[model samples]
Target: MPHNPISNVQHDVMHSLYMNHHNWLYTWIRRRLDNQFDAADLTQDTFLRIHAKQNVDLINEPKAYLATIAKGLVSHFYRRKSLEQTYLEYLAKQPENLAPSTENQFIILQTLEAIDALLNTLPGHVKEVFLMSQLEGKKYQQIADEMTLSLATVKRYMKQAYVHCFVLMENDFFE
Candidate 1:
């Protein structure tokens, strides 16, 4: 096998970390999720994400680092499931002919996840106005009344949301 000194060292460190703590991390996640299958998957994801960072040697507290990564993965797992369920519910209510193909569901879920991540970066009121207008089909005046804000403020929030989305799209960062 071809050897790159940096990658070889990283692999060894990652392997050592995994061998030492996989069981503990898996058990911790399993208890939280109450499912061995998901726990195992997330445990693997946590390690893979860490491995991908190529900085295994820099960690001083290996277990602590692994635990932090594992916890974040578990949270992401739940968030993804919630997003999928919400998308499914929305699709279920759509007219039969308007439903996307089964193959498109995965892509749509990924897109929604990306969009949700993007929205999470916005201020609370900005995100609220964007979702109310785009998802709930609310008028700006309605959002203003519900949010107890002036109509101009609501419009500005919507404008900010749209501009942010447009910039991300322009850079192909959202794709």
Candidate 2:
């Protein structure tokens, strides 16, 4: 195959960025996480995320760009860890006979992650209202009173949340 000059240029930029900043990025992540293994993994993930974007040439401040991406990855890593810990704690409290098998537990965790991702897509107020109604079983009037929102506003937020979820579900189904 013929060499593509644009692709080669992008590759060169990425290589230069990695060579110049990989160690610094790794150390920065390591300081935040205090875990060499996770730091190394997230550092590589950071590079991979940048590469996937195909915008290496546009970065003016390599360190700042990389730090922003790494920060998000670290946040996600902690969130996932917290979710797993919570699930494990819940499992520990379950009766032995009622506990799910390992495979089932894995499936349940994946489902929970999917649900979390879906909820995260909603606006903060919408998500809070939906959770209060669905998870906490709060009435619309009660939620409105507690949140200082009108009852109609609470109902609208719930409607928005349900529609958002339904659209996402439909897209997933089609995909």
Candidate 3:
């Protein structure tokens, strides 16, 4: 292959950034998380996220940039952990014979994560309306009553949410 000066410069900058800040980032994440293992994993994830952007050369304050990425990751880690804990607790309450197999449990958890991600993309009111109708089995009128929204507004929000989900699924299918 040909020598690429730009690639080499980016590589060197990334290497320097990682070498200078890896320890500090790890310690910072470790301070927020109880598990050392999770802290380590998230620190690596933070670096991977930055690498994906291919903008290491643009970062002027390396530590601040790293901390910002790490903070978002830490929030995501806790949210996923909380979701898993809730699922496990629900499973624990199920009759032993009714419990899902480990493989199914994993699949269900992944589906939940995907669903959560999709919902996060929707506008707040739309998500709330959709969740009320789908998850809580509430009627449009009931949702309207509870939220102080008109029935027509509730229906509009639900339509918006459904269209958002459909567009995302269509994109995924094509991809």
Model 2: per-residue Cα lDDT over 1-175, one tens digit each: 9999999999999999999999999999999999999999999999999999998999999999999999999998888888899999999999999999999999888888888889999999999999999989999999999999999999999999999999999899323
> What is the C-alpha lDDT profile of model 1 across 1-175, one tens digit per residue?
8899988899889889999999999999999999999999999999999988988899999889988988888888999999999999999999999999988988899998999888987899899999999989999999999989999999999999999988888989775
Model 1, TM vs. native: 0.89
Ranking by lDDT: 2, 3, 1
Count clashes in each candidate, considering only residues at least 3 apart in sequence or on different chains: 0, 0, 0
Better of 1 and 2 by lDDT: 2
Error of 1 at 16 (Å): 1.1
Error of 3 at 108 (Å): 1.3
Winner on TM-score between 1 and 3 is: 3
Give the TM-score ranking, best first: 3, 2, 1
Q: TM-scores, in order shown? A: 0.89, 0.90, 0.91
lDDT of each: 0.91, 0.95, 0.92
Error of 2 at 118 (Å): 1.8
Instruction: Looking at model 1, report the run of 10 residues with the lowest lDDT sum.
Output: 166-175
